[model samples]
Target: MADIKHFDPDAALETTLRLFWRQGPEATGIQDVVSATGLSRSSLYATFGGKHDLYLAALQRYVEQRSEPTFQRLAEDERGLLAIADFFSELVTARCTGPFARWGCMVANAHAATQNLTAQNADTQVRAILDRHHQQLCQALTQALTTARSLGQLAPGTTPRSTAEVLALLAYGINLRSRNGADAHALNQTMQTALNALTPSRR
Candidate 1:
């Protein structure tokens, strides 16, 4: 017979995700996971394998639970440029305020951390997650920009794909800057400036 499990793996993974999101994988240890999840080392290992594996799982959860839904909304919203503006507004609000403030985005944090690692030292799985995330973000932004272009909301020369790439980088910058104590007001101003530049002049 298979061994019976005594704890909720989903709950434990959610708890572990928050721990990793707050302190990041480098600062967090297996002991930290054990402590945060209230699980023994053996149980954690039995369920999640090891530290690297657990971090990957947590990162995947973040992408699925936190990032994807937001992206989906942006891609589907018919308001186009307004939807994108709301997206950035909410992003700045979430990043600069609330319980998770200063944590930045888990994926953005991973990107920064992974950049410091040598190619041989970097985990391919993590790199894949980051790449997928970038693609999803760009795709969503592209969809929104295409909508904006159809509605004559974009600046005359703006191309959806190129502008989506620029906006994706801007989003990453907001995430990183917010982690370093950039305030909501400042971030909002930055976001507005970027959006304004993409808007057609009304004259």
Candidate 2:
């Protein structure tokens, strides 16, 4: 017979993801996971392997649960630049307020943390996830920009692919800054400046 587990692994993983998102992987120890999940070290190890393994699981969960849906919406939306504007607006609101306030993006935080790690210590799995995230975000933005150009909303000489790259980096910047307590107003202003540069003149 298979061994029965007493705790909800999904629930525990959600809690673990939030813990890692808020405290980061380096600062969060197994004890912290134990305290946060109310699980024994033995159970955690049995279910999730070790700290590194758990952190990787949490990162995957974060991307699946939080990031992918948002990217999917942006990629499918037909409103062009307006969709992109709404995307940034919602991003700022989520980052600066609510239960998730100040937690930053899990992926962005991981990217920042990786910079401090020696090449030998860097996790290729983590890099892969981050790379996939960047590609997805850019693809969504590129789709939106393509729609915008079709509708004559794009400024003359602006290219969808190049603009998508800029906006992808900008999104990362907002994530990092918001984690550092940058206000919603500042983020919105910066987003607007970028959007305005992409907008066509009415005259």
Candidate 3:
């Protein structure tokens, strides 16, 4: 007789996502997934394949739910430098105070664990996530800075592509720092100081 499966895989994945988000795959083991998902080891293996597969799914979910919408909004926004500033400001606020507080970004966190991940699939997925994040930031900054330049918001000799690269690195830095429990105020101040260099001489 075929045994009926009683667990919700979607619900299980959500639980898995939270666990992986908090501790990351390097520290989180198969037993931790079983514990967090309330599933038997066999059930997890049968349903999700393995921890790496489960993490890949969870990472895709994170990008779809957490990153894509925000990037889209920021990219389309006409607020230029204010949009960029607001992006970092919101990141600090959410990272420090929200329900997902201290979770950092799964994509950014993945970079640190790349040296330890053995699976090619895991490496590919992590690289894809990072690349998508970089391209999105570049797109948003390009849109915003095009406007900033038109409005004289950028200083003379400002280069949009190079500046966006710097800001993207800043975004990744904030994600890692917030995961370590950095103060939101200090993070925001750090972000503002970075942005100040791009400001017009008047500000």
Candidate 4:
């Protein structure tokens, strides 16, 4: 007879997600997932395939649960540049000192990691996540720039397309720096300089 599954799959998946998020795939192993999720090897393989499969599932979970909502909020926000500022401020604060401090974003971490990642198609998935991130940032920035231009806040002839690309890359920099121990104040100063450049100069 087949063994009946007693544990909660969603809860187990979340536990695994936290483990992978904190330690990353190169540093994490099947033993870590087993310890974090309290699942037997047979059960884990039966339900989630293997370590590589579980990592992929965890990454997808991070994108859906953590990443999508924030991006949606930024894209829909009507606060223009202030919205972008809030995003950077909140991003660095969370990265430097929050409940989830120093974890760096999973997608960003994956992009930056140089160690052995044995998962199949991980590079392709990372590219997909980054491409999605870029598109979402561009959408949010374009909206904000249109509003700022309408209100005469943008300098003459500033292009939203290019500016959004710069800010998107800037955000990636913030993520990487924060992961490497950058302080929140310093990160905010960097954000301010970027925002100030985006604004029209005083006469």
Candidate 4 lDDT over 1-203, as tens digits, reads 98789999889989998888888888898988888888898889999998777877887888789877887787777777888888888888789887789888887787776335454576666567667766876777777777777767778778887888888888888888888888889889989998898788898
Return whichever of 3 and 4 wins on lDDT.
3
lDDT of 3 by residue, 1-203 (tens): 98778989999998998888889889999999988888999999888898888888888788888888888888788878898899899999989997999989887888777879887877887788778877987877777777788878899999888898888899899999999989999999999999898987873
TM-score of 1: 0.96
> Model 2: what TM-score?
0.96
Model 1 / residue 36 / CA error / Å: 0.7
Give each model's whole-structure lDDT.
Answer: 0.93, 0.93, 0.87, 0.81
Q: After superposition, how far is residue 3 of candidate 3 from its true place, in Å?
A: 7.9
Task: Tell me the TM-score of model 4.
Answer: 0.90
lDDT of 1 by residue, 54-133 (tens): 98899999999999999999999999999999999999989988899999999999998885555553568899999999
TM-scores of the candidates in the order shown: 0.96, 0.96, 0.91, 0.90
- Clashes per candidate (backbone, < 3 Å): 0, 0, 0, 0
- What does candidate 2's lDDT look like per residue over 1-203, in tens digits? 99899999999999999999999988899999999999999999999998888988999999999999999999899999999999999999999999999988999999988765555545787898899989999999999999999999998999999999999999999999999999899999999999998887878
State each model's C-alpha RMSD to the native: 1.3, 1.3, 2.0, 2.0
